[model samples]
Target: MDTLFDLDEAPATDPFDPSVSRPYDLLRHDDGADYAATVTGGGSAVVCGDAERVLAAMPAGCVRAVVTSPPYWGHRDYADPAQIGHEETVFDYIERLADLFEGVRRVLADDGSLWLNIGDSYTSGGRRTRMADRNNAARTIDFRPDTPEGMKPKDLIGVPWMLAFALRERGWYLRTEVVWNKPNGQPESVRDRPTRSHEYLFLLTKSEKYFYDVDAITGPNGRRNRSIWDINTVPLAESHDAAFPPELVYTCLSHSSERGDLVLDPFLGSGTTAMVAGSMARRFFGIELNPEYVSIITRRLAGRAAA
Candidate 1:
């Protein structure tokens, strides 16, 4: 395997520095032309493009496990019109995600599984503008999606379950829903309801009997893993706003995949999935639309190689 760049030496550049142009140009992997497989310990590739477009070029049934957190509906805009999560209506957002996962199901191995992490959203209450929040400056938005039909203002949209059932309708087996409890979740300004502190992680499979190792993810009490995960949310000091905690990815990887398995993450924000996959000796590749975010992925993976 080719070293990403001599692991023995210090990394030539810092990934967090925006001025650095070439964090490392990660080659796009398609069919048998997978340069990511050449990394010394484990392979990783970052495809910089829209998720649907990039997934089209990959081989069928090639992925052993998928661990991803697609963009949440009506959340912080990634500044791309083509990006998901900002549909005119909530149902439209679900349709778009369901349609994209159809391609994901096609590329998944028959016995493979998908661990999806998604958060819910509230109705816009007819508000068209969103001011920047001091806690999360990226929450600023130029446009706000209208509340869905038959829903009142400030209603909990339940987007996670909506998308989960949508995928189940598309032939995915919805096996489980894991509550990801964020003990250090960002404070919400709403006083009417309890401060939201959790998101949903749904485990879906392509077939009835899939490749999940129950023994691998035994709870601390030496029993089966429970539905609620008490993992803290990790903050990234980078341009990408929503980088899910690596512990979440690590737990998903542990339960669903083995070493050398090909793991896929369609929404590779900040490359957390790829970094954790490589550390565990699993081959990984991901799709991201932002070019700047793609640089973050390569720089991160390169840092892992150097370590």
Candidate 2:
């Protein structure tokens, strides 16, 4: 079996380097050579390219579980056209995600599972509010996408369910939604409702029965099967904006996969999934479109190996 793990071929791009000229510039292989070599290297293989294209190279049924938080709908743009979630409308966004996951479903084992962590966005006057562009590394107004039905100003678009139902319609068995309650939620200025403190993590399986180890993630007392999860949101100094805690990944991997099982993260932001997968003795294949983030993943893996 061919693997894609060529760390030495990576360009070692620095995120903080202001002298770097141009966008999507990676210090690694630009002709997709390292990406082709990704399957060869053992441990975590991080590919910096379009997720849809990268996932196509993966062998079917090679992944045990697919876990990663994709880009939020119109929240922030990573300055990449190939990146999802920056669509012109909420409907378009969900459709694009569902289409991307078609490859994901194909690569997933028959007994595999997919855990998706998606965030919500509010509509201002039947449209998504503008936020940071991330190209200049500053907060600014972004392009406004078309509004979806039943959304008013200051109303949450329910992006999670939109995506969930969309995926379910595409032949994926819609499973339970795990509420990720943040203990230290950011303060909000809304006076009509309570502060937002949670996001949804959907657990979907391709088949009726999958490789779920119920006893793996048991608490001290016994098996805790509650749906509401109290996991904190993680902040990173690297290029990633929305990163979940490693404990969250640990819980998902513990319940869905075993040691040495292959895991796939289609939206590898800071490479947290690969990092935690390495610590837990699981193989990880990560896909990220941003080159800077690919560099961050490379730097992070090196640090972990040294320690």
Best candidate, lDDT = 1
The sequence of per-residue lDDT tens digits that candidate 1 reaches over residues 102-193 is 98998899999999999898888999887777776767777788878999999998899999999999999999999988888887766799
RMSD of 1: 7.7
What are the TM-scores, per candidate, against the unseen true structure? Answer: 0.86, 0.83
The total number of steric clashes, by the backbone 3 Å criterion, in model 2 comes to 11
Off by over 4 Å in 2: 1-41, 126-141
TM-score, cand. 2 = 0.83
Q: Judged by TM-score, which candidate is best? A: 1
After superposing candidate 1 on the true structure, give the runs of residues whose Cα lies further than 4 Å from its correct spot: 1-42
Task: Write one digit per residue (lDDT tens) for candidate 2, span 166-275.
Answer: 99999899879999888866656557998788999999989988988887755559956578887666667786767667778878888898777777898988887877
Model 1 pairs in collision: none
